[model samples]
Target chain A: MIPVTIEQMSMRFGAVKVLHDVNLTVQAGECFGLIGESGSGKSTVLRCASLLQDGWRGRAMIGDTSVRDMSVAQRCRSLQMVFQDPYGSLHPRHSVRTVLSEPLKIHAIGDAPDRMRAALRDVGLPAEFLDRYPHQMSGGQRQRVAIARALILDPKVVFLDEPTSALDVSVQAEILNLLMRLRSEKGFTYIMVSHDLAVVDHMCERFAVMQHGRIVEVLDRDAITGAGAKTSYARELIGASLAYENAL
Target chain B: MDPILTVRDLSVHYPGAPVCAVKSVSFTLGRERLGIVGESGSGKSTVGRALMRLLPDAKLSAQTLTFEGVDLLAASERQMLRLRGARMSMILQDPKYSLNPIRRCGEQVAEGVRTHTRCSKKQARDKALAMLKAVQIRNPERVYDLYPHEISGGMGQRIMIAMMLLTDPDMVIADEPTSALDVTVRLQVLSILDDLVRRRGIGLIMISHDLNLVRNFCDRVLIMYDGRVVESIAAGQLDQAQHPYTRGLLAAQPRIGGGRGPLPVLKRDPAWSQPMEIPV
Candidate 1:
């Protein structure tokens, strides 16, 4: 079953059209990647699909319900988004416990204390971190808290926007492993956006290459290793990533 | 050939901090590129700043810190100012914050030249335009008058390079210079640096977290961890590094042909924080 779908989606900011007739379908329990450089409308697609940007044209569906028709409570239960910058996404004044429980409190979900502790453990953070502020945590620890906040509600679909780009190589490995482990245990669908081809290849099985606000090609993981990408832009991106690897 | 700069037993400690940020780091640089590779809070950038005496708040001490036989630690502030832009210069990570927002790109480059050399405004402006062209900026005249906000990120970085190289500094310390750039543009920027090092015979200290880039670009590499140099190896010999920290970092990066699997997280060892054993 398809957990998330976008058909003929178009978005314009006044005179500028950011997304042009974008379409995507994510399967249940699959990790789909959206790969592009800056200003490629990949994040806009996530925003439109998650109902964060309601001014887009065309239909976006989460499970069986269209995004426009879903109620606030239904939307909260179905999909959630994780932003690129963990430091900016989290509230500085709030403790880790407070940050995880706010979504539950807003949705009127009972047993907040138990759910918060479980969320911390699920993200591999100690229960003692509940009273710590965002500033007190490292970049990796803060990102884990952000992931916990996103998954605390048990949403069916989650969108990750450049999840580990800000982290160090070692810390990035830890976060990527944690994300993969969580997907297997919970069986939730993920839509990950990134500019790094190696990272996208590791996390996602099938990915779409976006250029100038349009998805130029969709390729499988096997295509990444082989010369199977159809578009010149996608080929260039792959070659650049490979060149960066060997550049040292 | 004699070294351009030499540092021995260098350490930095900011006020109120229990542990030193950089601990007894020692190195020697000639006309070749040296890379300092480490994660955040590993004191890689601190080493760079301490060399230039830029960290005002940090208390710095060294057995011997010399640049071309001149004692940097004992140099007065006025003498250091004269040597800064003329003999030694730095390129920051982001050109957006480094370049002045309101000044014309050409004027900024010309200002550096005029301050360093006893040149007229016209002479300084001509030298600036020539340097911009050297960095591969097409239509130098048009770009010369543009402000920082008008140009693209790649162009802005080139402009910063043009400005920094105007005075022909003998040594350049670049801190994560290409991290903010796109992969394709990163190559272009790096090649520009490579050209400068070859043509001018200037020593370079590249501070970055990217191990692959350092391995391929620099002649030597220093693997720093927790304010200490854990391993120092030739760039070509990075794969044979003996330190666990270096091996762990190499394994963490995902490769293209590598299949999907959980990457191994680095387990920190408390013993790695002990004083470094500098090779004689």
Candidate 2:
């Protein structure tokens, strides 16, 4: 069954239309890539899905709930988000236990302590990291905490925004592996936003290319082999990713 | 000819740290572009800062950091300040961080000229406009008056390049300069640097985390891991790098034309973080 459906989802902030007639669907347990350049409104769509912003005019159906039409508490159990910058995303003073357990506490998940510990282990984090603060841990460890917090709810859909951009190569590899494994085990649909083509090529099964507030091309993961794009903008992204090594 | 700059036994130690941020690392740069490639926590940036004598908050000591014959280590604050922009300049990684937000772009560029020369305010403004033109800013006159935030990221970087080049330093140390820019814009900036440095025969030290860019752009490559230089090879021989860390770095990247599933990840080694043993 289709897990999430977006129909003609157009978002405008005052006069600037960020997303225009955007339509997408995420299959259950499938990893979907949302690729775009900076200021291309990729993060805006993810924000709408995570229900962080409520002033959007769009048809966003997450699971059985109409997201655009829901109260915050009611939709809290269905989706959770992991932000890109782990340093800024997580509270510096908050313990890992507090950060993870707060989500469980909010969603009314039972046995908060046990659930938090289990979630940490499930995300490939050591049990010792529970009481540590974000600043004490490396970037990879903080990202894992963010993942654990998201998964503590057992949300049907997880929204990851540039999950591994701030990490080094080896650490990024470890996180990527953990993400792939977690998806298979938990069976949660993923809608991840990133500028890295290799990442999109690796983790995503189906992907959409965004340019200047519009979907230029949507392709399956298998179609990433070579020179094939109906739109020139899509071609440019592929070309840029291929030729110019993007900032990691 | 003697090396453009010969650095020996360079080390920068943070307060109360056991080891230096950079160990006894040594290298020499010539007239060609020398690319220093490394990741975060590596002493690559420290190397550049040590050469420029800008390592504030850290204790820096080098056996010898000779810019041609002048010793950067022995140079006084006033003397170094004079040489900084006029004799040698650096383009920082991000223009947003380096460029004065309060100052107009043209005024900033012209100030760079006025610091070294006896030029009048109007003459400095004209020189700044000419520098902008050299970087291919079409309407240099208009952009000169605008503050840092008003310009785009690429435009800001070009303006920075224009300002630095206006001083016409004998050598330039660019620390991850184009890494913040978009691909097309990055290539544009690289081409501009290439043109300016080559035409003027100025020595260039290009420090970046990107191996591919360094290989494609520089004349020589220095691969640094942790705090030491693992390998230094000619640009043409980059692919043939002998060191395992260098090979691993090359392998970690996904080539544009190569087919792939998942790209290979670099294996970390603890030894790379240790001090270097520089032979005499």
Kindly list the interface RMSD, in angstroms, of each predicted candidate in the order they appear.
1.3, 4.3
What lDDT score belongs to each candidate, Candidate 1 first?
0.90, 0.82
Fnat values, one per model, are 0.68, 0.17
Model 1, position A38: C-alpha lDDT score: 75
lDDT of 2 by residue, A1-248 (tens): 23887778788888999989889988877899999877788898888766687566678888666885667765666777888988888998999988988776766768887887799899888889998999899888888998888888777788899998877666676787788788877787899998877778788878999987788899876666656666888877777766655331
**Worst window of 10 by summed lDDT in candidate 2 chain B:** B254-263
Off by over 4 Å in 1: none
- Residue-level lDDT tens digits of model 1 in B55-135: 889899999999988899899899889988889998999988999999998999899988878989999989999999999
The DockQ assigned to candidate 2 is 0.35
Residue runs of model 2 more than 4 Å from their true location after superposition: A69-74, A221-225, A245-248, B254-265, B276-280
Q: Least accurate stretch of 10 residues (summed lDDT) in model 1 chain B?
A: B271-280
TM-score, prediction 2: 0.93
TM-score of chain B of each: 0.98, 0.95
State the lDDT of candidate 2 residue by residue for B152-191, as single tens digits: 8889999989988898888999898887676546777888
| Per-residue error (Å), model 2, residue B123 | 2.3
Scored by lDDT, model 1 comes in at 0.90
